[model samples]
Target: MSQKILMVDDEADLSKLVAHHLQKEGFEPLCVSNGSDALKALAKQPFSLVILDIMMPGEDGLQVCRKLRNKEETASIPILFLTAKDEESDKVVGLELGADDYVTKPFSPKELMARVKALLRRTERKESASSYAYRDLVMDVPRHEVSASENRVTLTAKEFALLEHLLKNKGKVLTRDHLLNTVWGYDYFGTTRTVDVHVRRLREKIPLLTDAIETVPSLGYKLVDEE
Candidate 1:
């Protein structure tokens, strides 16, 4: 079945345009003009991803994001924020609150669609070998599950892929470019910060990797063996 996406934006024209494009891309897009309705719709339905506008009446995007993250049932759903505010702080705030991506205002429909596709692609469960493990951290590839010791660790699709790549490489430092190419695909137009965001999420989810994933100054990152 085609994935369903929820787009919450006060701009009726923009929502229409995005919904049209998403339809053409074989997705079912549901548009809500306010944060209240968006939350209501989310509660009623299961959406694969949410395209949220940062500025809205009543509960704004950041408020909505925080609520979503707090909800156990809705927390893992991916979110992409649409914002006219291009400030780095705005983007950082959204990312820190669990937004999967952000697109500035006046963005090309094509580019937005690309981001949508890449984000959704990450949600697909990867079917591969049995598992990949580094000590107590284990990723069951076919099952799309990750666990530290015996406790499960919840990771987004992007985080899962990033951790998998790091586990596969082990000790080698991977450049951000290489990680972006390998994990997000070559056509992904996002910056290296996207990699950093997912990596941070990974570390937060798997506390055992607090120091395992090292940041190389003036370079990229490496997943090292636990001493």
Candidate 2:
């Protein structure tokens, strides 16, 4: 199937032009003029990615992004911010809030399409790599299976996602909020205690890596190299 993209922009002409270009590139583009409409579209039909304008009539793109990120079902869907602001801080805010990518105003169709492809490609690779791991700690994402040292470890969907997120960021400290936003998909309104619960459960299943994951105490958790 062709890649499905949802585009939210207040500018009618720009939205049309972008939709046309994306269609030509073998992508299925669905354009909406406002955030509410974009949400409506998503509720009615699902898409692989969303291209949102930061400013709009009723609900702004940032609000929509936040809402989507907070929802469990739609949170993992890739989000790309399309806006006129060019400040570095603005870009950081969007990414920090869970926007996977951003495109400035007056962007080239070719360049915009490139960003789209890159995000999609990276998501695909991550999905594939987990299943294709060379280590005995095997992860069958699609099948929801994990094995350490050739021993099977049962895990819930959330547990697996949390582990995948950490393992993918191995050797890095993942803040509690970051994990909540990324793994739980902005939908979880729970406290940091939620992360702790899952992490402990995950450790119980894979006891061999108990020391590999460290608690930040009053902060977050990190997966590090074992001695």
Candidate 3:
């Protein structure tokens, strides 16, 4: 079966164009004009990915992205933001809000399609192991669940990916650029700061990791066994 992708954008012409491209790539596309309708569509069915526009009438893309990340049913679905704003800060905000990728307006169809495929590939990729643990913090890869000190921890999809990478390569110094390429994909448009933000979040969310993730001055981070 073709994977279903939800495209939420206020621009009617753009939606049609994107839908056409998605269909050509063997993806089933569903277009909606606003956040409310996007949410409604999501409630009715599961989608493999979401292409969201940042600017809209009400409950803009950021709001909608937040809502989706908060829901267990929709949290892991990849979200790619389509926006006219090319500002760095705008892109950062979208990523911080749990968007998997961002594409500025005036984008080429080739570039957009590449971004879509990258996200889908990342989401669909499977881990070799079922779980990873460090002290009291444990990540159940198959279940898409995490716990710190036996307490369930809520993490966005990106956060989970970032942490998994760190755990998989424990004791190795991983640079921010490497993390971005591995976890966020080489197609990611943002800066290394994106890696920093997500790493900070992981440390914050998993208290045991506070001192565990050693920050190598001017280098990157290394996950070491807590002494």
TM-scores, in order shown? 0.90, 0.63, 0.93
For every model shown, the clashing-pair count is 0, 4, 0
What clash count does candidate 2 reach?
A: 4
Return the TM-score for candidate 3, rounded to 2 decimals.
0.93
Could you give candidate 3's per-residue lDDT for residues 121-224 as a string of tens digits? Answer: 77764756579988898899988899988998888778888889989998999998898899878886667888887787778878878889889888789999
What's the candidate order when arranged by decreasing lDDT?
Answer: 3, 1, 2
Provide the overall lDDT of each model, using Cα atoms, as 2-decimal numbers: 0.86, 0.76, 0.88
Give model 1's clash tally: 0
Answer with 2 or 3, whichever has the higher lDDT.
Answer: 3
Top-lDDT structure, candidate number = 3
Predicted candidate 2 versus true structure: per-residue lDDT over 38-104, tens digit per residue: 9999988788889999989999988998888666567667788889987877776676556766688
What's the C-alpha lDDT at position 62 in model 3? 96
Q: Give model 2's TM-score versus the native structure.
A: 0.63
Q: Report the candidate with higher lDDT, 1 versus 3.
A: 3
- After TM-score superposition, the amount by which residue 79's alpha carbon in candidate 1 deviates from its true location, in angstroms, is 1.6
* Runs in model 2 lying further than 4 Å from the true structure: 125-140, 143-222
Candidate number with greatest TM-score: 3
